[model samples]
Structures are given as structure tokens and as C-alpha cells.
Target: MTRTPRGEAPDVGVPAHLAEHMTVAEQHDWIAGFLRRHPVSRRSALRRGSGVVAAMGLASAPWTLAACASAASAPVSVVGRHLSFGDDPLRSMAMAGELTAPPQGRVVVDLGQNGSFGATLPVEVRRLVSQVPQADGSIRASDQYFVHALATGLQPGQGYDYRFRLADGTTTDTATFHTAPRQPTSPWSFTAFADQGVDMVPPSGLSGFTNAYYKPDDTRRTMTPSTSMVDRIAATRPAFHLLAGDICYADPSGEGEPVKSTGTSKSPSGFDSFDPTVWTTYFGLIERSAASTPWMFATGNHDMEALYDDNTARGALHGYGGHAARLDLPRTGPSACPSVYSMRYGNVGVISVDANDLSMEIPTNAGYSGGSQVAWLRQTLLQWRAAGSGIDFVVAFFHHCAYATSSTHASDAGVRAAVAPLFDEFSVDLALQGHNHQYERSNPIRAGRSTTQVPDGGTARPETDGTTYVCVGSGGRPRYSWQPGEVDRYRGNPAPQGDVNVVSYQAVGASAKVPDAVDWSQARYLDYAYVTVDVVPPPGPGQVTTMTLRTITDTGVEIDRVTLERRAR
Candidate 1:
């Protein structure tokens, strides 16, 4: 029984005629045929050792194949573990293990628990590979250990397989993963959501919280652990995760505490000082999904606490001041104010701004004045226009909103006054916000007013070269009810409370029946949902890009969808 370079178990069952120099595709086909002829049963002893090899007649006896195959099978137990992004491709893999080759690729043997344990693991191109370190502190060993290898510049849109070798001169395990599509036109889809905090607890004894408000009715809702929300979201297998804000309730020390509404006495330390353990729990539940895809975050009030020195800044008061500086975001703005940035993908430009920075005032009792963030926004928009960047679609996301109907959080009049004009000036197509905890959508509006007001249950305003606002804060956090008469559009009735509204939209632009609006709707209801934005490019030049927003429920159901088009200015 001859072994492969990676030292995997010898292919004893493989016929001698087909054993040499077969391509990967041919090897796969050969394996398929062999499996069909000899159906291996899980309960059969064949999997243990030579029992199956002896039946195949590949060796004089099971013992003969074991001596030759043990060396190869020894390494099969090691596999790839965690993979990440690194600045230098060569140096990146070095942290994991030694380099088989510097320029092209290298291999790291992680015999530690974090390394691959003879299981199938994925490897993607351009990703920094990691695995458990070797336990014996040596690369060579027959012991079951984990190993991770790193490779770079693999072609995109292609699938590749990797094999790990053991010190006993045998290959251990094999696994496969696909590279991301190279071009924008490649087929792909992603998921987006906001306000998924770690402290949210549903009502008890319920399969899922049905009350619109977050109040728990039974032990089930209360017992449904906050981390499970991450697991639920991961089951979707989305290409990416978009967190609107409040990822960790780092400020509040204990669980189930009302976020932010508590007085200064309850506030925690600075943001960095806040325990990362909360985030660890949150990530632990969803690492399976997050490891495969990128997570893009938009700052909410909770994230901004660290930046402020005032009483309101308590509870891990580290705002967006330098938040984005540490992240691997696709885009970042001026260094003076690093939190605000914009990145354009395909025809869409997603602008993430620090609304908290815009709210800061002088230390003394001084009058209100906008900060550098405001100036940066103006300059960024102007630069895009000056460059004649044909941005067909614009989506701006922040913590606060110009319009909100949630009773829990009143409309942030200050945010509306500060950012509304800038959005109008730039003709931003869509504005997404959280922090209100309720679900609300506004008519296409510019400046401080709506362009057109449709009647109740009527369709959204037509494309008019203006921006449409969406409040999607109900991402499994405590919900809040809307104040009476504060919102022009209100729709809550038969409120059994304890339920959070999950809103969805799509870009089809087709007419549909609208549900009865909720009046006195509290945004505090516990709910888990996401918004999907699909940009359908037009058939020809001078055509509009159709934008559809879909609100998906926890059960993979799309409850609501809205569509819009980019009107020619």
C-alpha cells in the first residue's frame, strides 16, 4: 500500500491499474465507483481497521495493509482550524506554523486543540489559515493532532482541496472550500440586520415570543438564552452579516437590564474596558457563520458611549471615536474622524456615519455646533459628485433616524436636524436606521419633509430622486412602543405586547396590499429579522436600478417587501 505525499491513509481499496497519476476529478470519479460497488455501512466493523481492506483483497491480510496504511492515516487526523485575514500573506501563515514555501504558499502544523483534528475543514483563497498546534512540539508524530496550512493567490471562483501530512510519512486528512467570485457579476447573496444585542431575553415558556412587546409571558421566553439568537441567524447561511448596532450590552453589568434608560449610576466603564466576554458569547454562538463570511457593523448609541465624557457617556462610554480604526472595513473616511466612511460595491455606495460624533458639544456651556464629521460628510459627497461617480444607488446607515414611530425611543430631533439636509443635498437613495427598536418606513423625502404622502395601506411614494427612510431596529433586542400623535403614520391595534415587529422589503415596485398599521406600537417586542436589499441593474444604459428591500422573519419567511427605482435627477 503506497502513500500520497500528504501522508493520508494508503488507498488500499483503489485498484492497482488506476492508482498512479490520476487527476483530482478522476480520483473523485474512481472513489464514487468503488463506493457504489462496496456499500460501507456505518455499523460495519470495516471502518475500524483492516476488516474492510481484507475483504477488498487489496492486501494478503488486514494486518499487512495496517502496517503500510498506519503511517498515512496518522496524518489524516489533522485538519485546518480557523482562517482569517492578515496584512502579509507570507508572515500570516508563519504565526500558525512553518512555511513549506514562502512566496507561493506554506504549511503550519497545529497539534494543539485548535488545530484540525482529522475532520473536514474549509480553506478559502486569500484567507489566513490557522489550526491547532502540534501537542508533542514536533511536526513528526503518529499521535492524533491538528495542523493548519496557508495558501495565497489561488484563483477566485474555483474550489480547491488540501491534504495534511503526519510526521510518520503519511497524509492525514483532506478538505475543500471555494474562493469568492472575482467579479461583481458573479452570483452571490448576503443578509443584513440591526440591533442584535447579547442581553435580549424573550418571554418565558413560549416556542418564540409572539407578544409585540418584549415582556416575557412564560419561562420559555425568558429561558431562550440570548446566544441562541446568533445560532438562529447562522442557520440561514448568509454570505455576510450586517450588524446595525448594540452588538454587546457591555455597559449594563447584569443581564436583562434596560439598556441606556438606566441612570448614570448603572453605566459601565469605557468601551474597551467593557468585558469582551459578552462579545465572546455572542460570537461563540455564530462563529460558524461568521468564520465563513464577513460581518459589517454600523455604530449604535451603545457603541458610542466610550467617546463621551458626560454622564450619558457612562456604561462603556466608548463611542465611534476610533471604533472603525481597528476594524477591517471595506472603506474608511478621513483620519481626523475615522468612524465615518463609504465603500462602493457594484452600483451601490454604502455610507456609514458616526451620528454620535455629530451630537457632541463643547465642554463648557456652549451653543450647538457641528463637528468635523459634518464637514467630512459634505466633502465626501462633493468628491463623489466631482469625480462624476455614477452612483446609481446610495444606502446610508447610522444609529439614529430622522423619523421613528417607536414609543420607546422618540425621534432623535437633533439627528434629523443635523443630517437631513446633507442627505438631501447628496440625493441619497435610502437611509437605514436603528435605536428606535420599532419598524417604520417613511415616504420618499428630501430636506425635512416627505415628497409625497400615500394614504393608509397605500403604496410607498414613487421614485422621485429622493431618499426613503427605513427604521429596522427590531433585531432581537428589547422593543419599544411608539408615542401617540408623534408619528404622522401610525398603525398598532390589538396589541398583546411582548412582540417586536419584523419588517421586510423587496425592490420589485409591484403594488401589494398593506397590513393594518400598528398604533401605540412599542418597539420593545422581542423579534429576530433581517432586511435584504437587491439591486437589479437595468437592461440598458440610462435605465434605473431597481432596489428591493425584503424583511425576513425568524422562520425564513419574508413578511413584507418594498421596491423602488433610481429616478433620473
Candidate 2:
């Protein structure tokens, strides 16, 4: 519920003419007063037994009461607690949490060792942004505010427990997060996926992100496959998680267009509605793992929430205003590109790119960053690859596939235009991409062609074999089928779909259906899956350093694995 004031509800009837203008709180108050005035007895309801609801004519409203309930529920102490790395992961961390409204005053964090509490307590920044009206200038269901906190000068590689304390003396549950190590000394692993939109299930637990049951008998709802996939990811105890892009499909249209005025949780209008409440649902879904470990994110085409853009900061281009508020990603990259930044973990340097700025399939936000992003990417790559940098491997994760062979969204020519040369020049070990809604690993490519064949379980020598590309976008909104006569040929055996042709779309702007025969696709899987990459530094002197990449399905099945090996300098 939207933090109702400490007063009695208005004991007034809702006038027919004024009902349309009534706020959700007022509607709730009107219902309370109506119930107080006319009590219902143990009898059958009129007009399909709808009870007092139908009698009040609210049941006949074009919108959904389900929406009202979603916004009208009791206030939560805390939700959507997420962790991220600050300028320096080893010495700093950031947290972002959501509340229905500003706390009675402020939210304090009590941090300590992983299992303990109260090591350091301090009041943090509680920036309150009143829930704006809906995208179409309609009343919002609930008040949503975000709180960001930064912890610096902490011990490196140490796990800490923290919880929020509101001024009202109420405390939230505790979550533990581990800081990044000060240096690359040992082995670790991380998981990556993309295109995982907020999935709403029906009562029967069948079918997709759209809730089949628009109106349910109660508040109970089912879970989506992506939710279960989070648990599977958690089981791996990854050092961190990287969502390549298309994090949550708040704008189901995948286009940064104006939203429909009538869209709500009750009537999302099926893949066309622009419901911001999906963000609320998404944060709640990922809060568990995101709270525990750094959940780094990238922007996808659907993530272009133009609804939050303002003429001011972080919204001038890319329409990243919502991300700037909700996520605490590193901002040291190109200006105006919140999603483009680079950080190092252990011996691996990871970079997040704003592929939407270079995407051709959906070019609405393309070139939003001008040419500065390319410059920053080049500088970051050069810095990481410089001698004495101690970085043995570099991985770039983004939305558009620089080199993929899926039918729906094949390799993006724009991204290939910008980053392909840079990646090959810097010997980027892995280019983890997402747009294509399947799993595909390409042979190590140099100059836009395969330099070496690195099949599943094969060794990839990026120092010589060039950069290998993997498209693991099957994080679970829906599955995309393989292209016609384009089978996932492996070990000379093809999937039951069709021929073993290497044809795919080189997704450019208009007339983008162009397909070309490719010879780089090495492995492919059409299902809901993610990739776990293990980074093992050299065991000792004269030992070879390696990064093993594995593709695991949502059902915990490991389908493909490849080892990228490089001799330690």
C-alpha cells in the first residue's frame, strides 16, 4: 500500500462523475467507507455472484482491480536490494534498494562481517523521487523511491552482512555481499545471460511473461522459469553475475515509443503495454542474488525506457534515466553512456558496452553516445592490455552480437563495425553477447573471419586464435527457433531442424533480412541457458593460465564447454 496517512479514510461515496479522477488511495478509502456503511451478510452476490464489488460498479470498470491491489497492498519494509562495484571493487561497493515511499526519515545501514552485524553503522543517502504519473500521465499505482549507499575503505575480498534500518525503528532483513579481491591471485567464476524480461505467470503455471490470468481469485501467483534459473545460478556461487543486456522488458514493445495510458498489471495488453510496475516485479525477482553478489547489467533495446528520460542528466541520450536511478553501475566510461564501463576482477578485465548505441536491428538509440564511446572503449582496452597491467584476459559483455549466427537477430553489423577490430586488436578472450535468443559459440575470429576452430571443449588461444564470441541470450522470456535450414551442426551432426548451412542475418537498419553464408559458428543450442566462465590463473611458474566457458541450460544441464588457454607472461 502507498503508505497511507495516519488518519481515518474519508467516509464519502464516490460520485460517478468524479470516480475517473479518483486516486488509488481515494478509491481504497471509498471502498473502506462503503464497507463500513453497508456490511455484506452471508449471502450470494448479485450479477454473477460478484459480491459487494460488483454492487459498487467497480467490477465494471474498464481497467483491472488487480492493478489496484498490486499498488494497494501493505507497504514492504524493503525490496529490490542490489549490490554493485564502485570505482574500485576491491575497496568499495554500492547498494540500491527500493521502497514504496521515503522512510519515516532515513535508511541506515548496519554492516559487519558476513555472519555478524553492527560492525559499522552509518546513515546513507536516501534520495527520494516521488512516483511520477504513469508514462501516459495517469495516476501511479504506488510510490517508488530508490536509495543508494556506498561503502568504501573496506577490507578486500571480505564478505559483509548489512541491513537497512528505517527511522520508524523497523529493520529489514540482512544480506551478505563479498567485496572484490585486491588483486588477481586465484581462480574464480562468474555467470552471464541476457534478454530475461520480467516474466508473469498465470495461476496454472503455463506459458510466458504475460500473465494469462488477468484477474485471479487471490494474491498468490506463480513463478517464471527465469526465477528458477536464478536459483540455479545461485547454486554455482559465482563471484558475480553479468546480465549481458535486455535485463527486464519493462517496455515490451522493445521500442522506445510512448506507452499506452491504460496499461497496468491487470491489463498489460500482451507485449505492447509499457508498464513500469514490471521493474518493481523484476527487482523483487533478482533481489535475492543481486543482494548477495554484484549483479552487473548492460542495456538492451527493450531497456530503452524513454518514459524516464528528462532533459537533464543521464537522460539527454540513450534514455538511461531509469537505469541511472535504479542501478548503480560504474560511470567511469564515456559520458552519457551509463552502461559503458570497465572493471577488473582477479586477472580478468570485464567491460560493459552500450551496444544499443551500435545496434543496427533496432537503431532508435544508435549512435546516442556519438563517437566518444568508441574512443573510451579503445582507451579502456589499451589500458587493460598494456604491459605490466597484470590482466591476463579481457571479456566484453553487451546486448548486440558482434558475431552470432541465429536467425531472428544475427550478428549486428554496427557492433561489428565498431568493436570487432578493437576486440581482435586487444586479443579480447571472450565477447559475450545477448541479442540472439539462443546459445551460440563462434570460432575465434580475426578480421571478421574465423582464425581458428575452437569447438565445444576445444582450446581457444586468443593470443593467437583471436577473440571468441558467445551468444547466450536464452535467459527465459521466450525461446526463438533456429533459422530455416540453419541447423546447430556439431561433430558433423545437425539438429532435427534442417540443413547444416551457415546462413544468418547481418542485422542492419532497413531491409535487414539479409543473410550470408558464415563459416565461424562452432556450437549452438536453442533453449533457455546461461554461461559460467571459470578464470583460473596459472597454478605456478611455467603453468598456463586458462578460462573455461561452459553453457548450462536452465535445467542444470551442461551442454557445451570450451577452454580458452593462454601462457602467463
Candidate 3:
């Protein structure tokens, strides 16, 4: 019958002094009876004595007190910051810590939005280190990571992981990466893809181009669906990833839309408005792997014209601008135009040109014609030759295809006419393109014309003089069909029948010629595969180099292999 303060029920076992005064009817009553008996003046003293008694009870009730304390002192953990390579080698790493070290290395974090919380977090560089190559001939350990900012240092070819500390004494982990195969002779591989964009609605009731490009559906009869090919590419773990073009369909509206001619068209159809956030999300998904590795991007027709329209109030779309300008890319040498640049690794020289600028009639009319780019290309190649750089191979990349058979876009005759001679003059090994959404490969041809044209337009015949043309635009956009029976199967056409194609082009030196009677019977088109190139140095103190292309599935399965060897005359 004992009563608690302001309550009806008390502990089952009560002290005799309190029990004697308890009553069920008194539950809601004030403590008038107790005050009267105790005298109000002495109440404070009485409460102090009761507190001592309660302390004794708490000591006896260990389980209950321990449970209360446990609930009150629970520990919580949160991740607060991250970092990535910015406009230059020096970039601040993102971080958050209540008590300790944040994770380190090259850290790619989720930086929510401009007005979003945690956007203004302080990012500082704690330290810098230089990694020297080791004795094993492997420079893997040569990679350096910025301590506070969580970025990797520039190395010949290496990858490194780093650690970061927070103010609260906590720590976080991150990693920075670089190209592999430090020595030119060591063999390394990489994947190539093109024409990926964010498409929410596609024609024919399809989800969009991204899903179709990946070939995620099993209902289709494609030789290799999207999942299979993506898996294959991932398994290979190529040192780097090459994106041909059409990265994001960011038009003035910031969505994938057909380009309209300014002269006649007042309003273009199928032009959808896009949210800038969507672009980042789409790229985040498309480049999940490449973000961890070095990715090289070349422009495509869609990507170049997709940014903004001068006539529109939207002005210029900055969706892809932030990423493109901030990525950590290898030096393509000093040039007036950084967009059009060249980078040499080992004995191979890669020249990335702005083909979109070359093909756009309006830009050319405005006196752009990518003339500066062309001059840069010519000068860079000539400089390499003059210095006796001994580059074993030369590969050029742009958005538009010099040769294409897809119904979507015609082969840019203008671009071919302008750049073909340059390729021939420099003895360029391969020209990688991706404007067309399908895959196509051409035989070695010195000029725009094919070396040996087949009567049926099936494939190219064997030839010893020409630059190889490869159209691998099917990165993750919608797929388009080639005209039936219009396959170009020259001696070098990799896949003459399927949607995927793979071929290898060799650089044998300036004096060597393309060998006649090359083999192409085993070539097959891949729906969603990647091409890997392995560069090997010549034996016995020779300068000759060899490159092998392996078309692999997303699971890292080698579907086809072609070898190109440089033979000096």
C-alpha cells in the first residue's frame, strides 16, 4: 500500500516508516499529511537523509543502474569528409572527424550539393611525399599520397593508399591511383568505350539509352548483352579507361536531344530539359570503375554540341564542366590548347584531338575549324620525330568517325579529308572514334579511301598501306542498327557479322608496310565489350615494339585477341 511521489504504486518492498503512512485514496493528494507530521522547517533535512538511503538502494540494485548508465553513454560513429584530385595536382581532401584521423589516400567522397550541409568543411594538405622506384623494376610503390588532402602523388606508374587523421583522434582511409607498367617494355592493358549519356526515356517504350547500351535485358538475342560485357571489362582491371565521346547528353536543356540546324529550324523536337544533378548522378554511375582508375575522355558530336545554345537563356550548362576541368590527367605536353594535347607513355604516343570542332560547319565558318588543334597535332608529331623520341606507336582519338556505316550519322567526310593526310604523314597506328552508336572497324588505309574495297561492301581486302579506323561508340547509350549486308570486312575488319568488333593495328616503324594477306576469319562484334592493349618492347636491344588488342567481356573473359607487331624495313 506504499505510495510514491505523484504516483499510485511504489516499490513492492517499502521501508516500514513509509509503509505505515501509505493509502490508496491518497495517491493524488498533496503531501499535507507528511508535512504536518514532519514540520515544513525540517523537510529539507529529511530529504537529504532520504537521498542517502536512495544511494544505498542504488548500490544494491546494480543491474537497473547499470542499464540506465549504458543507455545514457552509448557511443556513435559518423563519416564526415572525403577528397579527390582537383584542377591541379594540389587539391584538398574532404574530411570529418569528431575526435581522430580521417581516412586517407586519393579519396572520392560524396559532396552532396552547393547549399547542402557539410559543403564548406575545411580541407587541408597535411603532408607530401615523393616515392622513388624500387629495385624489383616495379614502380608500384613509387606512388605518393598527399597526407591531409588524401590525394595520390604523380609517379611514373604506381598506385598508393594513404591515411588521414581527424581532430577527434579518429582516422579514415583512402587511395590514389596511377597508370601501370612503369617500363615501356612491361606489358599493360586498358579498356576503351564511347558514347555514354544519361537517357531517361528512349524511343520504342524503352527505359533509355543507358539501359539499352548496357544490354541488361536477357530477352534480346545479342551475342553479348550489357551485363556480360561490363563484367568482362571489370575483370580485366585495365590500367586506364578510354572514353571515345558523348559522355553526357547535356544540351542547353541539359538533356539528350537531337541537334537542330540554326538556318531552318526554329525549334528542335525531342529536346528534353535535364536537371544538372542528374548529369552528375549519371556520370557517377557510368564511371564507378573509372573513378578508381585513370580515365581519358575524348569529345563526341553529341557531347560537344550538347552543352548550351547561344540563343537560349540557360546560357552554358556546367554539368560536365566541373568534372572535365578537375580530373587528374597525364600531361599531353605544353600547348596553347590544353583540350587538344598529347601524352606519351613508354614508347606509345597518344594524341587526343577535338574532332567535334573540326566537323562543326558553323564553328568552322566562325574560323575555329580546330585549326589550332590541327597545328598542335602536326607540331607535336613533328617535334617527337625531330627529337628522335622513337615512339613505337601513335594512336589518335576524337569524337567523330572518319568512316562509319550506322544509319544515325554519316562518316564525317570533311574531317576525314582534313586529318587523313596527317595520319598518313605521321604513320599513325590507329584512329579510335565513337560518334556512331554501333561498332565498326576498317582495314589499314593510307588515305580516306579503303586499301582494298570488296565488291559486296562486306569487308576490306588485304592492304599494306593505310591507317586503321575503329568506331567503338557503344559505351552505354542507346544502340543503333547498321544497314543490313553493309558490313565492311577488309583484311583487318575484326568482326564482320556481329554487333561487337575487335581488331589490332601494329606500328612497325616509318619504313615498314602493312603486311598483305592478314587474317580476319575469327572476328566477331561484341555488344558491350572493351578492348585492351598490351605494349611489349622488342628483344635484343632493338627498338621495335608490339601491341596486342584483346576484346574482353565484363567478366574479364577474353573473347577475341589480335596482335600487331612493328617490323622495321
Candidate 4:
């Protein structure tokens, strides 16, 4: 309740005499405790990063001189720390976070066993933040110094505590995360969702119908239901999470081009509403989970960020330069596209596909890979399925639904044509998709045709029944209505009645939405939702392996449940 002292360095509620006597780690802890007592609005922090230091007369105050030193000379505090799975989920992992200021000394990441550091790895920091002062005198820090750290030589399927190590052995608070097991018999789980963004932060461009009507109160620890869902996911204790894309709607227009306007990012519009701070807010919000869990993200149309076209030569990067710096996705084929990659955890083989490369609906960044992604995908699947590969299930996730029934974006024939055939040929167990803002599942299909009706509770054998496609796009955005003449995912209390026909479409060259009739929509729910998959590895080879999937809503209801089973090799 106390205000910052005027014409003085912010005390951080600590006496300077005592702070100077305390250790650097203790000083950092004191600052963090100060933040807990006196909260700072995210908006003000983004706009006034340096205002506090300047207005507080830090340089004039000898008590604050050491803290006010440049980050290049001293270790700077960081925000939005997160992790991702590298090429090897067991032995290696990727760590990323952002810093407002530059770093001069090596930023070390300590992998802790018990309470002590077992291994220390240094990180590479890149200056990717560009500030464009708005007419309102507020700086739009769309980016900042991103710290990318990789840790290896870890024991498979083990839990380790990690923290950022600053100069003089000072460290951030520790968080625990688990790696994947190395054997097929190891059981594990994961969480998934898409289209989720920061809730109700209009300045960050997270205006869900202007008031975040989709958010519901769950735990009092967080303000947004998205964060609550993240906590719930962490409760499930997943080894890793799969975010199908549309990660953060920083550029809500999804048109690839986000231009500044007289009435800017605070309000939602067809165009001219781009605020880069939304990424900061979203990342800060997800730190609870992303800091401890590996959130593997795929590419979506909304993510085709064209906001950072700083260099015309690499304009094809499509704001992806920013993404690459923040989320170090593991890629095999090309550096040009960072979203396409493959990872393995125990008996499951996971892949992240960049649907932006194959989308016809949002074609701005389409074809950037020139068919290489598909080729690499084919090779990866083949290698995973080779004789004695030890892989039992292969799951692929991406944005741009290939078999959805939403009226907004029913199905991208381009996505279906490119990946569906490959998935079918390679016996992909599941294809998770997003960008539609609802949840819809499909029957097992092969060669673009539904093989048989696998009901909600039916067990699907992908090796024979075909691949099952699911659109868990209901991460945390506004709910979407089903296509006209089609029923909801399933019958509800009153039930959504229609002509009982699935009207679908494939976008054609940005000029039209080609229509067709289909009947693959299994269960539909127009609400904020997420998914959790419990992977049950086989006891031994030639045994039954199961993946029990539970589709849960924001209201804490299990609307649909399904199982994917196959024999272990």
C-alpha cells in the first residue's frame, strides 16, 4: 500500500544499508519480495521499463548505484522463462526466457540434483527487441533480449531442478521438470491445446469479446482461466505439452501484416491492431507452467508474424525471427522454418508440422519451405517405423485443421492433401490441430476417406483403423459455432439441432471457400477447452499399448473420452 518514494531510488522495501550488506542472491530475493508486496501493472512495466529507474533518480542515489548498472556490466533480472524439448527429450532440452536489458557476462543455467547444481551450461543471448515509440509516448517493446540455453548429458526420465545463474553465484528460484523415459514400457502423459492467448489484457490485444467473457474463475491464484488451465495441466504432471499453434494472438488480424493505426492494438479489428506486448503478457502468464514443462508449439496462421520485417532479404522469416529466438523448436531439415521438427519420448514419436507452409487459407507464408517439410516428414516417419525402431505411436500436431466442422475454418484441403496422405501412409496415430476455436474429433480415416465409425469411447487402432484427427482448438479464445446444418460434437442438454449434414470447405487461393458435404464431425463443444493424453506403454513387445485421451472444458467437465491402442513392436 506504500507509494514509491519521490526523488529517491525505489527502496524495494529494503533499507539500503542492509541491502548493501546482504548477498547478491539475498538482494535479488528482496527485490522479488518487494514486487509481491507492491504489484506493478504489466501495461505500465512494458511502457515504462526505464521510467522507474530514471524517475527514481537512481544514479543520484548512491544506495542504488550497484543495481542501476548496465546489464552488460552486471547480471540483469529476467522474465518469461520457459523450456522446450530438443532433438533428444531424455538427454537434452532447450531453455528460453527474455530480459529487458542486455547481458555482458555469461548467463549460466544450473541443472540441479536435489538442492545442488549437477551441471552448469552457459546460454546465448540475442538482441532481437525493436522499440517503436507510439504517438502516446509509450514504447512498444515487441521484443527483447532472448536467452537460449541448452542442457545435455542428463539422465533419461529423471526430474531435475533448474534455475538461472547470475554473476557471483547468485541464482533465481528453482523449478522442477521431468524428462522422457528411454524405454517403451515407461508410462507418461502430456497436455495440449491451441488458440489460447492472454485473457482480457486489451493493451496486450487479448480482448475476448472486450471483457474476456470466456474466462471463468477457477483458482484464486491467477486472474485468467487460461492460467488456471495451465496450473491444472501442471497438476497432471505431463512430461511435455503440445501446443498446436495460434500460441499468442499478438497480431490478431492473422493477416500476416499488422500495421499501426490511429486506433491501435487495444481494440480488435480486421487490421491495424498489432501490439507486440501481448507476447510479453502471454509469456509472463504461462511462466507458471512453461517454466517447468516443455511446451512444444506448432505454427499457425495467426503466428505468421510479419511485424518484424526489419530485413527485406529475410522477410520470408515472417516474424519467425522473433519466434526462433524465443521458442527454440528442434528442426531437422531447414533453418528457414523453425517450427517443423521431430521428438521422441519413451515409446511415442512426436512431430511438429508447420501448417503455415501448407495452408491455402492464410497463404502469406505458405510454400516458404518449397515441399521440403513434407519430404522431411516422410523420411522421419519412415525412419521411426523402420524395422526394430522401438517406436509404438507417432503423433503429429499443427495448426490449420484438416478435418474440422467449424464454419469459421472448416478444413484446409491443402493441409489434408499434404499431411493427411502422409499420415495415413505412415500410420500416424493422431493428428492434433487448432485455429478453429472449438473442439471436434474425427473417425479414423485413411487416404482421405473415413474407414469406420469409431465412437467417442471406441478404441482406435491406427495401424489398421487409420489416423484419427482432433481439433482441440479451444485453448482459451472465444468459442466458435458449428457449421450450419451440422450438429454439435454430441447431443447436449437441449442439444444443438440442425439439418444433420456437415457442411465443410477448403479455401482456394484466398478467393473462395470451396464447399463440400461430409460426416466426420464426432463430438463438438463450443467452449474454452483443453486436452490431456495419458500414454500407457506396453508391458513388453507385441503387447497392447494405450493412449487414453480426455477432453476437458473450462467449466471442468469431461465432454469426450477416447482411447488409441496399438501393439508394441
Score candidate 3 by lDDT. Answer: 0.41
- What TM-score would every model get versus the actual structure? 0.54, 0.79, 0.57, 0.80
Q: Model 2: per-residue lDDT, tens digit, 1-569? A: 11111111111123323323333234344444544454433221111111011111212211121222322333435667888998788878887776643355667787888467755456544332212223333322222456777888888888888887777677678888888886657788999999887666221111226544223431112245577678787777789999998887754434222223332233244212344445656777787788888999988766664434442343334356667777788877877687888888878899999887886666656676778899999998888888878788899999988888776678888888999999988899999999788888888889888887766679988989999898989787565667666665433234453432476778765335566677788887776778899988876545799999988777677778899998765
lDDT of each candidate versus the true structure? 0.41, 0.66, 0.41, 0.67
RMSD for all candidates, in order, please: 20.7, 11.0, 25.2, 12.5
Q: Is candidate 2 or candidate 3 better by lDDT?
A: 2
lDDT of 1: 0.41
lDDT of 4 at 270: 33
Across 1-569, the per-residue lDDT of candidate 1 in tens digits comes to 21111111122122323433332224334544544554433223112222111111222212111222433332222211223222221122211111111112223332222233433323222211111011111110011111234445445444444454443444533333344433345323445666665543111100112234356542223333334445555565543456666554433332312112111222233111122122323443344455444456666545532211111211111233223222344335645433456765445666776554442111110011236667777887776655446556677787765655554444555566667888888777777887666556666666545566432233443335467777777666665554443322223323443322223211111122122232212222234456666666554456555667666545454545666676322
In angstroms, the error of model 4 at 371 is 1.0
lDDT of 4 at 559: 75
In Å, residue 188's CA in model 4 sits off its true spot by 1.5
- Comparing candidate 1 with candidate 2, which one achieves the higher lDDT? 2
Best by TM-score: 4
TM-score, structure 4 vs. true: 0.80
lDDT winner:
4
Which regions of candidate 1 fall more than 4 Å away from where they truly are? 1-183, 186-188, 199-213, 217-239, 252-274, 305-327, 360-370, 385-390, 453-465, 485-527, 567-569
**Which of candidates 2 and 3 is the stronger one according to TM-score?**
2
